[model samples]
Target: MRAKKIYWWLVFSLSALPSLYFGLIYFLNPRQLGIDPVEVLLAESGQWAFRFLLITLLCSPLRRLKLRFLSRYRRMLGLFSFYYASLHAVIYVVAWIELDWPIFIQDLVSRPFIYVGMFAWLVLLVLAATSPKAVVRALKKRWVILHRLIYVAALAVMVHLWMQTRGAIGEVLLYGCVLFLLLAERLYRAVPLLNHQSVGKSANN
Candidate 1:
């Protein structure tokens, strides 16, 4: 029990420190962020959001590989994804648009990427809100169905990133490949043939 607590504490610290450092740098030394600090912060937060979402999805594959301990940290990683996503939205509203509702609505209409990103954020919001143990318990099997929307949210994020990029699609392609593999692994596990193979192997053993 002590070890598990220590492991999660380490995970939380490692996950949070970079965000905290960037936040402080943005506020205390805006000059350090270059001329486009708002853009930099927005990208940084959004990237972290994507990363955490990927990590959350990776947890299941890792568990299948026998790293069951990772399951415990999945919820924390998912919540962190939402945290950075919310920060990204707040920066867009407060810093970029300066809370001008008219401009905000206009940008959302003008930028299809913004629309996709916001939709993804909304799905993350739903997942985060229902992440509590009590809520999960109450939802029962339905919780699993609702949380499966993470895959959709991830696809939306990739599209959001892809649309925002001008040239250099290398990074986007890399992340997309990773998402593809994760999805493939999930499908592989779900296939009845694979299940039967596993059962046969166990029986033979």
Candidate 2:
């Protein structure tokens, strides 16, 4: 099982290598893309971040189905989500705004979408920082409470993506639909009937 988990991470990391390679190409040769290079970077980073957010959300649903032991990789997926979000923010600041203080402040205050994205990233930061087993042990009950921030973070991420997309929101709507279904699944399975069945199985074991 441990070997299989390591292999999965390797696969994801290898697949992500292309993104890094493209980023470098954009850095060394901005004219490669017809659009602004910074815009390209931002779009890519944001896309991957959302993809990872969805991946993290899938862990629980997959677990319920008794699919492979995905819970072990939840922290990895979560940290990757945070990593891409940070990259997105950095590109926005360094490439887009050139780290302009006044403009940064203005956007943060005036742009509701930016605010939501920023809040989501902040929550991811806290979660990623405290994901260590030692911290989880020390925090005990509080760990569970803090982890609830994932729900809020997911909402913020979806809203951010929805706001960023221009006309014909088909892609955004599709992602929204999937996540909505995921949440519904979680709720339906939370019923006492399902809980009783689960408890019964545990007792039998």
Candidate 3:
């Protein structure tokens, strides 16, 4: 149990390193952020958010491959994803727009990618809120259905990234391919169970 606790702290700290590093650099070494610190923060935070989200999604496939212990960290990874995602949104609102609600609403209307990104963040928010043991118990089977929205969030983030960064086309494609494979694997795994259910229903009928 001590070992498990230590491992959890290790993962929690490692997951937070990116944000910590970014925070330190932004305050202490602002020169490193180039002439556009706000833009740099926005880009870095947003990228890390999407990366963590992808890592969270990977837990399932890794568990299916026999690294069953990885399943235990999925919630941690998912919350970290939400952490970075919130950081991204905060930087955009607080730094980029300087807490200007009118400009934020303008962006929401004019920048369609912001809409996609916000949708993804909202999904993450709900998933994070319902991640606790108590909430999971309250949700019961519906928890599974609701949590499946992670795929939708993933796809939306892909679209958000693609729409926002034309220069990073290669990175976009790489993440897209990874998301596609993860989604495809999910479908592949579901097929046999679905077929079995169908057969059982037919037999019953």
Candidate 4:
């Protein structure tokens, strides 16, 4: 079952390759799409960014629901989230900024919100690189700590989406609600009652 889940994830992602292909082609030649190719790319990638972000969060909740196999592939889904985010950043730079390095640098410096997005991406790069088993074992003590950075990543993504499109507050609010609920669930599960019960059991032993 777990193997099939992973297989289907690959299949699903493969199905989306056409979008990436056209996105790239349209990027190289803006005249391909009758509509604004850049807008289409941005919208599609942004939707994907949020979708993957939600999936990453859903890993835990789905596991709580006894869908245990999901945990096996959380890292893969997370890396995909970062993948779409990177593409979103590329679209912003290549399509919107038109590869004007100096102007882009200036914009990054001037725009407060871009910092939010960039910081998230930086953390994501670290997370994606360290997703392997060897690194996780090597960083045993630090592994869990490092992965907790995903909360910050999620926040950064929300801010990125909120700021990038001025009127997309509805979508932003929806993501915000989901994130808040997920974090709250974690907190609830970590309550003193559960901790105390565990401690008492350990002491009795």
Cα lDDT listed for each candidate? 0.87, 0.81, 0.87, 0.75
* Tens digits of per-residue lDDT for model 4, 84-185: 878878988888889999988887798867878788888888889998989988987577778878888888878877887675578778878988888787
lDDT tens per residue, model 2, 91-182: 88898889998999999999988889999999999999999999989997778778878888888999999987888799898889978987
lDDT pick, better of 2 and 4: 2
lDDT of 1 by residue, 1-205 (tens): 8998899899999889878988899889988987888889988999999999999999887876788776778999999999999999998899988999998898789889999999999999999999999999999777887898898999999999899888899989998999899889877766865656654432100
Give the Cα error of residue 97 in candidate 1, in Å: 1.4
> Per-residue CA lDDT of candidate 3, range 105-133, in tens?
99889888999999999999999999999
Q: Where does candidate 3 stray beyond 4 Å? A: 197-205
Q: After superposition, how far is residue 78 of candidate 3 from its true place, in Å?
A: 0.2
Better of 3 and 4 by TM-score: 3
Q: How high is each candidate's TM-score?
A: 0.91, 0.86, 0.93, 0.81
136 Cα displacement, candidate 1 (Å): 0.8
lDDT for 115 (candidate 4): 78
Overall local distance difference test of candidate 2: 0.81
**Global fold similarity of model 2 (TM-score):** 0.86
